[model samples]
Target: MTTTTAFTIAADGSYAARLAGEGDALYAERWTLAGPEAYAVPLPLAQPEEADSEVLPLADGRVLIHRRVAERHAFALLYPTGAETGPSTGELQLGGVEVREGVRVRLLPPCPAGTGAFALAAEDTVTTVWQVTGDPSGPRPVARIPGRCSGGVWLDRAGRLLALDRELEGITKAVAVDLASAGVSPLLQITEDSDDRLLLADPDSGLLLIRSDAPGTARLGWGVLGSSLPVRFPECLARTGEARPFAVQPGQSLMPETCGVALRLPEGDIGLWRPADRQVFRLAAPTGWLGGSGLWSAQGRLHLPYATPEVSCGMVGLDLPVSPPPPVVLESPTPTAPRPVPLQQAPLAGR
Candidate 1:
């Protein structure tokens, strides 16, 4: 089976980077998705990359790969040297920083601007964010956040603000890190005691998909930035076996409720939902799908990338059926003086 962990697409959905191999022979592969048809351009060096090596695609048609080499994590940009063909050769642009020993580093999600890439290096009590590329100079540390952090989500189109779930003490909360000043501020605090995480955020629409146990159990919910309205935990999102929201439709600035959300279900199926519709339409996943990887166009079409035996690079676009909007309804809260900060909205799948 193909290793799914290293598969990643660019923020703009123009390219993809993945590790394609079995057992111990793993090599980095880049897929160009902006053309009429998808094609893979292999980037294999003299030796194979480690099995656990992580790769991310940049908007400039280069692939950034992170590899662990005895006590240090190295970063580099890979690109094809000649025309795309079998046994293609690639050159590694070595300009990233070599992380210190004993530090665990991982690449964050692609920045919204698609020009820069970032990663978190966590030590004992602090995590540092590094700008690996997109700058004239070499890699440098941008932010030093207190406590261990994970789950990176860019909050602005300029890539100025990043949201990360921090774990200090025993609780976890999502906080926004301002890249300019390295300032940290609370972004989500549903309750005094809750593990809240920001799963995904759309810079265009200010729509945030969050996962938190503020409602007793961990459930997926949605909230808007700079909005006083409480977060809504619609029942349609409470599904079994890890329903992760991966892609959010762009260009829905004033209609966050109408934005298309593509979810990866437990059984590797795709779940399409919109806050206004309040229902999840299930769709079958393409074979050899890089799970939890896809992109949504403003036109309501979801493009999923996949690789199969006969076809090396392929992508499929899915269009959801249209339905009229339902009446605005709210779920009744239990009889209490103060309702939950995030009102539990009524079940939305079937109403």
Candidate 2:
């Protein structure tokens, strides 16, 4: 099995990952998401500087990749060749298009209406909407967001682009863009200095989940389209004393799938809240200093990037079961064993 450098889980719960170890060799691996691993198909790009690649699974089973070559970036559509061999080779459906100049592509939403491709964010600062056509090499731009955009989502069932714009006045406003018409319109305008982060939207319900810090603490709020006032979840409270919200995620495994919000407390503890049932879970002080932390993945996974006495820098993954009421702090079932490094004998000692 090849060593994986980075990986992401597909919407279908399968895994599409890239591996690169010594010698800068690159290989793409696809596997099942379920625990017990299965066969893997490896494709070799085989380049010294082949770093930073994104694998986006298409609705039709083909995977779209944005790989960096030389100093430029290109898009490739990869699929099974139906032959059993090394480096599952496939045709290059596209090449030589700059998705976002200077910055790597961050997120790629699924294609919609067979008319538009997807939108890509550069360093989470600049956003550009790309139209993926049958001719892969000819992906054209639909719209370019002017400033830094965050909390992006494809709102409608048709996947219309929706995002929160962080304005110059330090205000975050909800904005929507029509991909077909290239029309940008402001959906909700927030005046408070609180960090108004967009969570998720249910097209069927027209209910937009948002996290806002107004009461000197982060709180869960929900509102529908054309509505300026948001109904705040009175039960959910921020454990963090900083009056800021760090992360907000919608419960996936729950019966109805409620919203879970995490707050970074000043004392370094993390407070998790479920807005639907008004339940709170608290994780004690992190194992180490809390440089930063968040709900890192779409799945129920929390990643804390911190420094330890032994390890200068590392990310610890907390394995907690996903249920109606998720656990706040995860306890490792087995203790991590330490490896000792042998010291070399001194020349003076030998003499």
Candidate 3:
């Protein structure tokens, strides 16, 4: 019953938080990734958290745990107690967010600034985004978007802008939320009648990995933030069944096409590819992978974290090379070819 968002990495990539335990004894665990050897520290409270509870890592090494109690969602900060406090941990309750009986709430991805955390409270026709931390007063509502929103990706390094897939009138489109101004604008609308989602984004290169049915079927594609170029879906990505992109190499500020992408395939294998290349090289996934939990470095290195019975905490660093560009193929003009359309209607500010 582990929640899908159980594993999360801090915005700075120095720490990770996840729910780890066997059977009925689940607790919060934090991994120190900035050190030479990765290790995990358990932060178990007097009571075990339910399997469905979500944990998010903060830049300061504290974990934000979200639990559902009746019609309210409670929040708490968990940290390891100092040695003087004796081999234990401390939990500071930050209160809770109340919702209607049938509404559901979930934690959003960590903000890029690493100073605050956020979550979404969703109902039938609207979703409320809340800033859960970084304010002395307490958790407060940031924006009330007009749709059933899902999928969260930070579009900038400052964490001021967030992209969400919003479903309205039976159509899903990606939109950007300005946390500073509480404004919403279109981010991705591949077609008038199609579902488009922004799965992952790299702020350094402005590379956006997307999935859309504009090609008649949902397929993986890549687009730039401010560029008017249309999204490109390579045939190679279509060969794989529903590729789930997990990480994109950062620090390629000028070359978004060369950023390495890590994908979790449908067959339980890991695939590495780049927008410049048309091939996906597959690798065997490590055991006990908090599936889809990983980070990429500016130097084209990927770090994947996992925990198993044999090894309590471990990280795998893979230096995946950027694939060589494929040769260009000349094609004859065809009457039935689809037209190239920009994924987004307009370039967002601060891109």
Q: Which sections of candidate 1 miss by over 4 Å? A: 83-88, 93-102, 135-137, 327-351
| TM-score ranking, high to low | 3, 1, 2
| lDDT scores of the candidates, listed in order | 0.80, 0.48, 0.82
lDDT of 3 by residue, 1-351 (tens): 333235789888989998877777889999889989988898998898898899998999999999999888999899998777687888888878989987879999988898689999888899999998877777899999998999999988888888988999999998998888888988887668878899998877778899988777788988877666767778899998787999889877757777889999999888998887879999888887885778989888888887767867889888885566763322211222121223543222232
**Candidates 2 and 3, the one with greater lDDT:** 3
RMSD of 1: 5.9
Question: lDDT for model 2, on a 0 to 1 scale?
Answer: 0.48
Instruction: Give model 2's TM-score versus the native structure.
Output: 0.59
Tens-place lDDT digits, model 1, residues 282-314: 988999787568989889899998878888788
- Among all windows of 10 consecutive residues in model 1, the one with the lowest summed lDDT is 331-340
Per-model TM values vs. the true structure: 0.88, 0.59, 0.91
Which is better, 1 or 3, measured by lDDT? Answer: 3
- How would you encode candidate 2's per-residue C-alpha lDDT over 27-79 as one tens digit per residue? 55443333443334555544432556765555454566776665556676666
In terms of lDDT, the poorest run of 10 residues in model 2 is 338-347
* Weakest 10 consecutive residues of candidate 3 by summed lDDT: 331-340
Winning candidate number (TM-score): 3
Order the candidates by lDDT, highest first — what do you get? 3, 1, 2
